[model samples]
Target: MELPTALYLPGDDGGFTATPLTIGPWDVTLQHAGPPAALLLREAERVSGIEGGQTVRLAYDICGPVPVGPVRVRGSVVRPGRRVELVETVLEVGERPLMRLSAWRMRTRADDPAAAVARDAEPHPAPLEPAGSRPEVPAFFTTDVAYHRALEWRFAEGSFNAPGPATAWTRTRSELVAGEPMTPLQHLLVMTDAASGISAALDWNTATFANVDLGVALHRPPRGEWLGMAARTVLGGTGAAQCFAVLFDEAGPIGRSSQSLFVEPRAQA
Candidate 1:
């Protein structure tokens, strides 16, 4: 069935409906497909009947563009707990595996339980100033949020024709799903994955990072406000690269993210 163009738009609701797309050698783009995994992991937590706010961590691998072929999603538990749960999913193309995603869901815990006189100093990234408008770049642009509605982005440093890493401040546009309020860690996940590891060069109008395998790990949960991502490529090599990033929620450092990269161009012949 042909998916609606609007359905592909980004947002919390929009993210729930992803249409898999196929391209290149062993590559598939998962469209409007991220946040639903959030809901899915949460559901698994509920079905297990666990208590407390479980921290859900997700990591995905794109074997190929799962978009163009017949795909199926199946998930299972690796380790289950009231505080943490591990699960994995595979997007298979008629028995041939196309992509796999793994996740860890855990309930939130205080960053410091032993401290009494906390040296709590806030590192807020300025109030969200509404930088405005989602991007309309090609699908190859990994950070494009044109498909998302619930989350809007404003780039502190635009990736267009820029070298080095990119920085952006992002926040949620919608209120709490159940009106119970979302935690800082939940906010961190919303913006953590927007920026990829490579930068575009003017010569080819393309930024390619080959052999890209990446993940974001948050040590301290964000405490509301605009979460800032100071992202940059740490190293690169022949057909490959790696990046390191520090995440800030304005109160202090929330956590960090690192990814393996494979740089390439958009208009490849």
Candidate 2:
């Protein structure tokens, strides 16, 4: 069988076909949450019909492990508003449902310094050097997965292979889709799924964590290609955990992202 060249390719029936880029950490034969999530938002934006609105929130629920290969993506507008719109996208492989994504798109108001009275803004550290590369953390064997190779990453603080909180700058070199240009929101969404790996509270060799859901809220749309995430993972004694991150671009803080994880010890070999 041929390996996937891109994340997806258009299908004859209006749905797009899935590729190996969908592969996730849990299984090589399965798909990652990042690609599908971004793809869902892409479809949702198309269906929203809002001329010029920013996606304020993007959330996803992982129904189960998404298998690799051809999957169908369907999107529709669930709520309509002049200022805001709600859209949903579902990914299914054959007859099995994999995941569902919901997004909130809001219209942008003209920027007027006089009218912008005390706008809430998040504080961010000085932006990392975009042109420099840091050493890769060896502990992140998860990075060995096929999907992880699709993007370029530079860590300024914590390494995905190392424990504790981390600050990472990431970007994609290849198109998520063959011909379609990826949006700023899509670029930001791609890195949101990396939150858990960026800052591991537990050892990857002994513990396994899978995020069951992902939620992202953006104060504003990202401007440049470089997306920086300052992330931390928290694991509880009760086998529950959360990963949180503050997102930024070269300009400044754009928003935040979170993940609810299913934490457990990996079965001994």
Candidate 3:
């Protein structure tokens, strides 16, 4: 199938149409959490009364599977403030809510050399570029899925097929929304949810790990198009798991992201 030009296209009645690029590896009909999470933050940033603030924290809760179709996006300033504010955005298919994002936007002073601290906090320098493009997608993904195709992946440490922790760099080929350029935050959010899939601790052929929520905290905004993540997944005995990643740009460590995952055995075909 020919991929859409963008992940989402604006529609009438304050809605957006999710394109094939939003489809995930788990289901062809359902949209991936990454695109929708970015959409939520995109809409939250556009909420009235919150101009000039930068989102420092983003908490996205996946209420249900977001379908690849028309979706209503609504945003509001739940807790308005002069320096700090809470913005909420919800994506709904008809009356059913698919996801909600609560973002904390804050005002920041101009960069000051004297005010700078923790400049050498985590000395995780960006890894050397991968030798070549990843040759194959995870076995669980169909060859026709557009989401994986929409983003370019280059692994610095482990690969899609390799188990255990992996560090990879990723950037989207398509725009987040048609005609409008995606912001740095949008680019980061669009690839954040894949931390679990790339750094799987369990065998994909045997177990499935789906994240229920994603939380991200950033001390500074990301720069450039490519974002890197050094991620790992930790599974508990009780079928609960968490994926954590130290987010990075070419400069260095920018933030961290964590995902709460629900793990179970993959059903036999």
Q: Each prediction's TM-score against the native?
A: 0.62, 0.90, 0.93
Determine the C-alpha RMSD for candidate 3 after optimal superposition of all C-alphas: 2.0
- What lDDT, from 0 to 1, does candidate 2 have? 0.78
Using TM-score as the measure, name the better of candidate 1 and candidate 3. Answer: 3
Write the number of the candidate with greater TM-score, choosing between 1 and 2: 2
**Model 1 over residues 50-111: C-alpha lDDT tens digits?**
46654435565656433532334566777777777777766555676655656676676665
Clashes within 3 Å, all models in order: 34, 3, 0
Q: For each candidate in the order shown, give its overall lDDT on alpha carbons.
A: 0.48, 0.78, 0.84
Count of clashing pairs, candidate 2: 3
Cα lDDT tens digits for candidate 3, 134-193: 434556676475678767788878878878998888877888989988788898998899
Any runs in candidate 2 off by more than 4 Å, and if so which? Answer: 1-5, 114-122, 132-145
Q: Which stretches of candidate 1 lie over 4 Å from their true place?
A: 1-16, 19-49, 68-72, 92-97, 107-119, 122-145, 148-150, 157-161, 173-190, 197-204, 223-225, 265-269
Residue 14 alpha-carbon offset, candidate 3, angstroms: 1.7
